[model samples]
Structure formats: structure tokens, C-alpha cells
Target: MPRTVSELMTPHPTVVEVTDTLHAVAQTMATQDVGSLVVAEGGAVVGIVTDRDLVVRGLAEGIGLDAPVGQLASEELVTVGPDDDLAEVVRLMREKAVRRVPVVEGDQAVGILSLGDLAQALDPDSALADISAAAPDE
Candidate 1:
């Protein structure tokens, strides 16, 4: 059987509502040790927000913590499904320059497929997977 996204994706990835405040979002990020989150509204993923977004768009712009995360999120979303082909997923990531994509099924965010996930799944013994698992010096 071919490896599907569901086979490799991180299910129930950390999520935050669009109404969530930046302060709350930052706390979630820190607690989960994740760099990004799927931005949801009405139980549907509407966008994505990264730790970089919090710094560049929220803090640097003088946006208060009370401000909604939606304001800083990228409403333009790129998503995939659990059943989709892994090759297509890789292509999308390469073409779109996106590191992560929320796996959605009928407007519901089911899981997340990340480049690291792809690397580990596709070539566990390869150097790319090693690089993907590496962390920068603190």
C-alpha cells in the first residue's frame, strides 16, 4: 500500500481559534514547542500563523497582545487531505515555499503535514531527514 498523508501526518496538531489573542497564541506556541498553528474559525481552518508572525506582525507593529490572532494570520491558506498523494504534497511544498500544510477533510482540520514529516517518512535514512530533525544552536 502507498503511504498516505494520514500515515505520516501529525494528527490533532496544536490549534488556535481566530479569536485567540496574541498573548494566548504565544503561550500555546511556547507550551507546545511548535513554531506555527492552524488558525481556525467556526471550527474550520481559515489560515495559519507562525511564531514569526507574532514577532514581525504583532510585536514589531505595536499590536497589543489583546489583539486577535486573525489580524496577524495569513488568510490565504494552502491545505491538503489525508488521502492525497505524498508526491503531490512534496510538490506543493516546493512550489509554494510553505513548510507546513494543514490536512483538512470537509473544512475540518484533521492533521498537519510538514516538511519534516515528509523528510522522515520519505527517506528516514537520508541526510535531509537528519537536517530536518536538527535544531539550531541556542
Candidate 2:
């Protein structure tokens, strides 16, 4: 049987408020060792911010790190419910070209699922090896 998204999702993913500073968000991501954060307000997900977002949108735009995260985050939020099938989640991620997706329960965010997380859960060695091989050499 195929795994459900709930089975693969990282429960209780870290979140940040729209008012949070980009520097603070970066600190949170570093502390949590996560690449993305769900942007929430009043217990509802409004957007998402990733490390790439900081580099591509923030830095490229000359926005200071002290600027509000909401100023640079992608407002077109894409989300999935815990009960949603894994295939559906993958499809949405592919269509949106996003690596991370927030998992919602009603109006609140309950977890997150990333392409890496899903790939690892399904097949660790092969997935990791593939990623490693595709990564640019340092």
C-alpha cells in the first residue's frame, strides 16, 4: 500500500509570524535545522518562506535581514491536508515547483512535508544517493 502524506509528514513543524524579522526567521531555521517555515497569523497559514526565498527574493531585492519576513514571503500559499494522499501532495509540489508544503488541519497548520522527507521515507538510500549525486560539488 502507498504511504499517506500523514504517514510521511513531519508533525508540528516550526512556524513563524508575519511580523517576525528575516534574521529571526533564519535563526529559527538554523536552530531547527529546517529549510522552510510556515508563515502563520491567528493560527492560519498565510505564506511560506524558505532559505532560497531569503537569498533569491530578499537578498536579490536588497531587502535587509532585519526586514519583516512577510515582506518577502510568497503569499500564494500552497497547502495540503493530513488526510490528503501522498501522490496528490507530490503532484501539487511538482506543479508549484515547491520543495516544502504545509499540512493543514482545518484552519491550523499541523505539520509539514518536503520532497526530501517524502523521498527519504519511501526509500532512504536511493533517494539520498540520487540527491547526493545531483548536488553540485563543493
lDDT of 1 by residue, 1-138 (tens): 346889889999877899999999999988888888999999888999999999998899999999999999886799999999888888988998998999999989999988888887778888879977888445
**What stretches of model 1 exceed 4 Å from their correct place?**
125-128, 134-138
Task: Give per-model CA RMSD.
Answer: 2.3, 3.4
Clashes of each: 0, 0
Model 2 lDDT tens row, 1-138: 456878878899888998999999999988876678989887678888999999899989899989999897787888999889888788899999988889998878898888777777666678563773364443
Range of the 10 consecutive residues with the lowest summed lDDT in candidate 2: 129-138
lDDT of 1: 0.89
Worst 10 residues of 1 by lDDT: 129-138
